[model samples]
Target: DQQVKQNSPSLSVQEGRISILNCDYTNSMFDYFLWYKKYPAEGPTFLISISSIKDKNEDGRFTVFLNKSAKHLSLHIVPSQPGDSAVYFCAAPFLTGNQFYFGTGTSLTVIP
Candidate 1:
C-alpha cells in the first residue's frame, strides 16, 4: 500500500511556539520526501524536503527530519506564526517527475 500516514488531523499552538507534525510511510522504496503547506482551496507550497541520503533538512523556521530505519519523518516549525496556520501534507515520490502520494493532512492553528 502507498500509505503515507499523518496520525493527527489537527494541531494547535500559540504564536512564537514550536509546532510539530508527524508522518509515517509504509513503502520502503520511497527515496524523496517533501512537505507542503496548504491553505483552503489553494495548492500546497513546497516547504522543505530531504532525500534518502540525508537525515535532516532545514529552512528558516521549518525543519524536516527523516529516520530511514523507522520509516518515519517529522516537520518542526519554530516560533510558529499565525501565517503557519494551515494544512500540511507529507508526500513521497517514487521517482523524479512521478506523482506523489499524500497523507491525510494536518490542520494547524496558531493563536496570537
Candidate 2:
C-alpha cells in the first residue's frame, strides 16, 4: 500500500515563530520528495523539494529534510508569518509520469 501519512492534521503558531510539519511514508520507491503550500480556493504551490539521494534541501525561510532510512520527512519554516497560514501537503513523485502521491494535508495557522 502506498500511504503517505501526515499524522497531525493541523498546527498553529504565532507569527515570527518556527513551524514544523511532519510526514511519513511506507514506500521506498519514492525518490523525489516535495512540499506544497495551498491557500484557500487555490491550487498547491511547490515550496521545496529534495531528491532521495540528498538528505536536506532549503529555500529561504522554508526547508525540507528527508530521512530515507527512516522513511520520514519534515518541513520547517522559520519565523512563520501570517501569510503562511494555509494547508501544506507533502508529496512524492509517482512511477507514472507527472503523477504524485500526497498526504491528506496539514493546516497551519499563524496568529497575527
Most accurate candidate by lDDT: 1
Q: Which portions of model 2 miss their true places by more than 4 Å?
A: none
Clashing pairs in 1: none
43: Cα error in model 2, Å: 1.1
Per residue, candidate 2 scores C-alpha lDDT tens digits across 1-112 of: 6479898999999999999999999988899888999999999998999999999998999989999999999999998999999999999888874888899999999999
- Evaluated against the true structure, the overall lDDT of model 2 is 0.93
> How many residue pairs in model 1 have overlapping backbones?
0
For each candidate, give its TM-score against the true structure.
Answer: 0.94, 0.94
72 Cα displacement, candidate 1 (Å): 0.5
Q: Residue pairs in steric clash, candidate 2? A: none
Candidate 1 has its poorest 10 consecutive residues by lDDT at 92-101
